[model samples]
Target: MNTILIIANLLVLFTFIIHTFGGDKNLKAIEPEQDSPKRLRIFWTMSRGAFHIVSIDFLFATIGLALINFTDYFQESKLLLNLLALYFLGYGIAFLLTLIISKKFSNIYFKMWQWLLMLVIAGLIYWGNS
Candidate 1:
């Protein structure tokens, strides 16, 4: 469990760094069309990848919290955990589809909404683990 928490934190931190710093120069260079098919696909793929990576942390955090909240209700938490896990699975699918087909959602760390969500999820992860 400790290992899982640490891994989650690392992933979140790494993602934050990349999302924050990785594309600044590029963003300035590219005058992306907001609604173009190519741009939209790139946006989706990027957003999806970021989402699932953060979801890993959320998944672990929720599991950790569920464990702490109700030790005897492990079975119940298992269902919740399984559901969260499935979201991550679906995230991967959507992410990959965007990468392969749409090419817009790829590496999506642009929108302020997504960045804020990542931060919120990180906080949730910390609370869940703690």
Candidate 2:
């Protein structure tokens, strides 16, 4: 059994839970008012859709990791594991680049700590595949 992969799977599962439930309040806050312009409303709708799509992605990743760790189904699929790792690494890089471009260094770590979790998860996945 790949212990590192198992841990990564657990983390991904936890991330999915938090992102789905814990982010609800924040998501609601961004909702456009009924009286808002059509473009604003449309943007909000698209944003919300994108947000939920990420949650779904995380859910799928969690399931994928679980299958890889607990079953022989994906045991030999190193390329799949690498793809997952790259996906997460890209997410982390996106967050980091956003933070850098924002020029808000006051609270560097707390500003976008999600990047750290993403990078760690990516590293664990890659390491486990090896």
Candidate 3:
């Protein structure tokens, strides 16, 4: 289980790094060029900030998980473990709620993908507790 977590965290960290650098292209592709220069600039700036924040947040999460798995630090903290599980559960619930209530995204496949991801997170939490 530790090995699985280490590998998953590493992969997520790598993906976050990639998005931090490459996300601008995807954002630009989605945004229209005909928009006003001011609006475009503001959008791009906000997008870049969001990307950076996401990358840093993932980096911290990855490091925290790695430490919990591989080091003596926080290894025996039951409270921390419970908090992590709660975080996972809360995130899963958020995904499910969003998928259920949001009609803005009509893609069933995407909804299914989110549901599966939520299940995986819940499973990981359960495994950790067990």
Candidate 4:
């Protein structure tokens, strides 16, 4: 078994759990007031959808990585593995770029540190495949 991929799978699963349950409260906190403008309400609805969309992505990644590590189902699917690696790499890069562009460099490593996890998972997937 690829131990590194297994670790990556576990991390993805953990992230899914946290991003789902733990994030729900934060999601609720963003709800627009009933008296808010129509555009604000619509934006809130779209934002909520986008938040759950990410949860779904994490769920799928967890299942995909689990299958790849625990079974022979994807033994011949190098392209799939590479694609997953690239997906996480893009996630990490986008996250870092957002932080940079936002000019939030003070204590950047600890604040909104999900990018670190993303990069670590990407690295593990690539290294395991290699």
Give the top-scoring candidate (TM-score).
4
Candidate 3: the clashing residue pairs are none
| TM-score to native of every candidate shown | 0.38, 0.90, 0.64, 0.91
**Relative to the unseen true structure, what is the C-alpha lDDT of residue 87 in candidate 2, on a scale of 0 to 100?**
99
Report residue 112 deviation for candidate 2 (angstroms).
Answer: 1.8
Which numbered prediction scores highest in lDDT against the true structure?
2
Clashes of each: 16, 0, 0, 0
lDDT tens readout by residue for model 4, 1-130: 8888889999999999999988877988988899999999999899888888989999999999888887878757577788999999999999888887886667986788999999999998898889
* Per-residue lDDT over 12-56 for candidate 2, one digit per residue giving the tens place of the 0 to 100 score: 999999988887668788888999999999998888788889999
Clashes counted in candidate 4 amount to 0
Name the lDDT value of residue 24 in candidate 3: 62
Quote the positional error of residue 98 for candidate 2 in Å: 1.8
Ranking by TM-score: 4, 2, 3, 1
lDDT of 1 by residue, 1-130 (tens): 4544445445545554555456444454553566768866687668656645664555455555445344655655545544444444554455445445644553554432343444444444444444
lDDT of each: 0.50, 0.90, 0.62, 0.89
Off by over 4 Å in 3: 7-11, 14-24, 32-44, 104-106, 109-115
